[model samples]
Target chain A: MFAAAALALLVALILLVVRALKGPTVFDRLVAANSIGTEAILLLAVVGFLTGRPEFLDIGITYALLNLIGTLAVLKYFRFGDLSQSGGEEPEN
Target chain B: MEAVINMVLLTLLVVVTLGVVRLRNLFAVVILGSIYSFLMASVFIVLDAVDVAMTEASVGAGISTVLMLTVLSMTRVEEAKPAHSPLLPLFVASATAAILIYGTWDLPGFGLAQTPVNTHVGAAYLERSIADTGVPNVVTSVLASYRGFDTLGETAVVFTAGIGVLLLLRRGRSRARLKKRQEERT
Candidate 1:
């Protein structure tokens, strides 16, 4: 049922946290953080169903959008020294 | 079953916090912080605080991570080694935590109808929210209508944060442009 699925998701979240914590490279941590966001969205939707409140799904959708924007922004900032930098040419690192 | 879930989530949160504390790399710490926020959102949902959970998910997991990473990009990715010993701070933190946990010992059991919060204002809200505001979601009615001023203040805080970030990041661009213009003129 929902409880079982939630438990599984919790396990996955813990594993992701472990990966994030033990990452030897920055990209590894970033990937772990992205996966954690994905798991949170799923957790929110599943919890909404378990609680019989479908309205919570609206918040879940918002979280998903924010997650996407945040990951892309961080990646872009890392690639370019400035956030407002144009994507036309690569900056010498 | 719910209690079990809550306990499990809370334990994971503790583990994540410990990881954040032990990790010296700023990038790992930021990632762990995001994971911690995700765990907290789930805990909030299990407590039936859906609105709080939503805010935590968006602000804590989403915005805070991006902001922290942005800071990392501007600074050194690796944390500096501390010159001082950590024992004194550890002792102080442990004492504070112990006292705080002890302070919670006298709180009423969760969800008890006879508790002051449940019997007093909560009862009134549950009874009158539908009739007064015609909103089926009592939380929405309470936040948007009944507590209009408080919601407005929260919105203002978010607006201020957005403006602050824009000012901080955009200033560099303007300065660079000014330097280029001055050089060209010379």
Candidate 2:
């Protein structure tokens, strides 16, 4: 049952990767990439279980954090024309 | 039963990959991508790595989708056409896929008790982890204590990424000062 599920996810990941490659827009690719990272975390955990090595769970947690930060940073950079310009607080100008 | 399950999983992986590539709408694509992550997490569960499954579900299917969607709200989800052709990516991706598929052959058969990985330092850690670290989860013990230094390094790296993002996203002092001066003049 689990194997089948994992297969489904692997397929999704491959598709996402292609989308990332052929993204019609940068955001489309970013979305795809973000999804892929998410899938990979799951994949890591699943594989760890199948292999009977539980350490992968930690890696998954770390990966999740990194993925979120990376996605947010990318989005922030693309917005406001300048990443240097922070949101939420207005510049005196 | 296992064979049937593996076959099904493998088929889904392929189909989703194709769908992701073929889809035109960026929103739909993101949704599909999320589906893929969710499925992958399921696969991990089947593999018997419960801890891993938890992380995947939490991180992959949960946080990632939210982060991406948030990013989507800020930018154009769909991409415009590039001036150049895209044949190169297709060629590269397929070639890389072929190589990775071939590499899987060398991996130990799943769940083999005597596999080299289980025999070596892994066994030592597994055996001693509970007694030494007083942690029931060997994974946690190994990550936090046996190889604590490596974890520390990894944390530092993440911190650096956070710092880098903060610095990059932060307004320069000059810009802030200029704005302040402008306000005074006004």
Candidate 3:
């Protein structure tokens, strides 16, 4: 059953890769990349279970944190031209 | 099952890499590169190298993608066309890859206990690590105690790189401030 789930995740990954490569816009690619990260995290966890080494879930947790950070960083960079800049929405006192 | 997963991940890696190479848009290329790294980390996990997989996920997929995007923000997003044909480089790359694959043909099969790596020093390390360092994870004990100096060197290298980046960014900030002060004086 874990094997079947892992295979399904791999199939999802392939589909995500297709979206990423065929993207005509940067946002499309970005979304695909984010989804790919999600699929990868799932694959890692499922593979860990399949291998009977559930300890690999730690790596999955680490990956989840990194994926969140990376995706946010990219989105922030897209919105703000510079990473150092405070969000322009707030009026300075 | 492991073999099937490894093959799928490796194939995905190749596809993403090809996309990275063929795409001219830097942003899309960076995204594909991150995908490539994700697949690579999965491959490492399937191969039972959890620590390496963790490092790949954090460094390859996370930090490098951000770093590359920052670099792209500083420059034109479209890659410039090369002046020369890519044929020679392609031929060279293929030849190198072929040679590497040929070399691997003679290596022992994967996960064999009798392989030199498993039989030699690795066996000794595995046998002694828990007793020597009281670390449950053999990788942790090996990295922290038995091969402590190597790990220290790796840490020192990372520290040096971080300091170098900090110095460069500081210089750039100070220079900008100097320019602003000069403008104010005018």
Q: Highest DockQ: which candidate?
A: 1
The single-chain TM-score for chain B of candidate 2 is 0.68
iRMS for all predictions? Answer: 2.0, 8.5, 1.8
User: Candidate 1 on B35-124: residue-level lDDT in tens?
Assistant: 788788888987878888888978887788878877777799778899999999999999999999999999999787888888778889
lDDT of 2 by residue, B45-106 (tens): 55655556556655555556555655565577675666777899889989999999999998
lDDT of 1 at B118: 86
Error in Å for residue B65 of model 1: 2.3
The predictions' CA RMSDs to the true structure, in order, are 2.3, 7.7, 2.9
Candidate 1 vs candidate 2: the TM-score winner is: 1
RMSD after Cα superposition, model 1: 2.3
- Which sections of candidate 2 miss by over 4 Å? A1-93, B1-16, B24-35, B50-76, B82-88, B172-186
Model 2 residue A29 CA deviation in Å = 15
For model 1 the local lDDT of residue B3 reads: 77
Give the local distance difference test score of model 2: 0.65
**Native-to-model Cα distance after best TM-score fit, residue A92 in candidate 3, in Å:** 15
Clashing residue pairs in candidate 3, if any?
none
Question: In every candidate, what fraction of the native interface contacts is reproduced?
Answer: 0.69, 0.06, 0.78
C-alpha lDDT values of all predictions: 0.82, 0.65, 0.82
Worst 10 residues of 1 chain B by lDDT: B171-180
Against the native complex, each candidate's DockQ, computed on alpha carbons, is 0.65, 0.12, 0.64
TM-scores of all predicted structures? 0.89, 0.54, 0.88
